[model samples]
Target chain A: MRKRLRNDILLIGGVLLIAAAFALIFFLTRKEGAYAAVMKNGTEIARYALSAEGEYPITDGETVTNLLVIRGGKAEIAEATCPDQICVNHRAVSKAGETIVCLPQEVVIKIVAETKNAPDMVV
Target chain B: MRNKKTKKLAFLGLCTAVTLILAYVEALLPPLWAAVPGIKMGLPNIMLLFLLYRFSVKEAAAVSLVRLFAVALLFGNIMTLAYSFAGAVLSLAVMNLLKRIDRFSMVAVSIMGGIFHNLGQVLVAILVLETAEIGYYMIVLTVTGTIAGILIGLAGYLVLKYLKQKEI
Candidate 1:
């Protein structure tokens, strides 16, 4: 009986830990930067902002998906290229220290708060 | 009876192939609503668990190596391969060692493997990124890995149980 109780406790604890982690990710952060396009090889490929009230189209010489979503006071690609479309399913990102990357297409959408630049002190 | 060894080798190859296909399939799943990104299903893991119970440890390790390399090559990520390779080797070693404990259930062993795998990957991530910030992600990963471990373990347990009952 003791062992069973211990196991139950452990399982409950594990579930709570996971829930807390997700909550921390969702709530504790403040809004950061405006939407910015991630340019590579001099091409506009990705855009990110404080919220996803706008639309951003992304392409990779083949397929294109117009990603739409809002996160952390910005708007960016909630989806993108290729048949799998897994990237499109990754909804909007809206928090500090959060990132979304499209490896196959070499596109990264990120948010940066304006106040983040205050760390100018030399290391 | 004429080619038992050859038959065994063929079975191993099939296991490895199935695992590779599953790995890619899971990789293609869209991430759910989370700040962090990851693949779903962990389908290849089902094969690994099957081999662990049905075959010897050496055979399971062999299948894992082939599947890992094949998936890495198809995915075209050498860096990602290194992290996964480290995790696979370490997790396999831990699980194999723990399997020797008479009282340890396969479920427990699988859970340990899952935990160690996350630890190995997080260690690699810390090394590759040259930052300690990634360590924070380990807590989240541990919870995820443990849940996945339990589900996969139960699947393996049921399969082994069925095989034993059928005497196959």
Candidate 2:
């Protein structure tokens, strides 16, 4: 039992160490994103600049599925028709690689790095 | 031989039923952390671990596949099925590999299982969303997975201890 306990402790410590390292590296490399890209059903539907402050309704056909709010350099889901409301309850995200995903709505809001030369508007 | 076959079938059926019930219970409960999407207690995995130890990798895998299809068809969406299928298969692969090594305990195997499960789900999320940025969640999910792994491992360890005398 003692050896088993030691092995378990060692395993837990090692795994946690790796996870901490991953988090540190992620934080060190993370930067503020320029665009809040929205995807519906796994395809890019729209992109909103994080620098801009506005409310954008992410519609699927005629019905709005999610209401996205960008303010103070952070993006968040303000309203969603999804049953879980996990995305709506999420904290606003501003860092690159941050996301607010509504699985039920199949809508994803991701903070992404700005392209060197951007197109006028894809959506 | 026929009697042995009957016993195996009965045991596997029992495991599948238990896994399905656990899946239902897990679904009824809310997410552990609302901010961290798809973080589950993975209560069903306790049975998986039991099967792996008491029987073999084959039994565990069979039960896991059945549970995935059953849960997806009964209450979940196709996307959910894809994510879970990926997670379960990947997690089982790593767990089986580690078990074959014979160095780590069940607790260790289960921790790795939890981690790989998240890895699989993250991969699917990336593919589905077509964005690498969703990998950000992997950081948080790893931490949550570790905690959940410890819980399931401890629970499984206790069960194994109790059943050791009877060899059930």
Q: Highest lDDT, which number?
A: 2
lDDT of 1 by residue, A5-76 (tens): 465456546755765776576556645455444543334344444444545455555556445466456555
Q: Please give, for residues B1-168, the per-residue lDDT of candidate 2 as tens digits.
A: 888788779878987999999889998997777766778899998989888887789999999999999998898889889999999999999989988877788888898899899999889988886777678787788888888988898887786677657623
Model 2's alpha-carbon lDDT is: 0.85
Candidate of highest DockQ = 2
Q: Would you estimate the TM-scores of all the predictions?
A: 0.63, 0.91
**What C-alpha RMSD does candidate 2 show over the true interface residues after superposing them?**
2.1
- Report clashes for each candidate as comma-separated counts: 16, 0
Candidate lDDT scores, in order, read 0.62, 0.85
lDDT of 1 by residue, B1-168 (tens): 648778878878877887887877777665543455442345566677777778768888999988777877777578778878988888888778766643456666676677678778768755654433345555566667667777877887786777655422
Q: Which docking class does model 2 fall in?
A: medium
Candidate 2: share of reference interface contacts reproduced: 0.61
In model 1, where do residues sit more than 4 Å from their true spots? Answer: A1-123, B165-168
Can you write out model 2's per-residue Cα lDDT over A1-123, one digit (the tens) per residue? 678668777877887888789889888988889988888767787888888899999888899989999999999999999887889989899998788888777788988887666553466
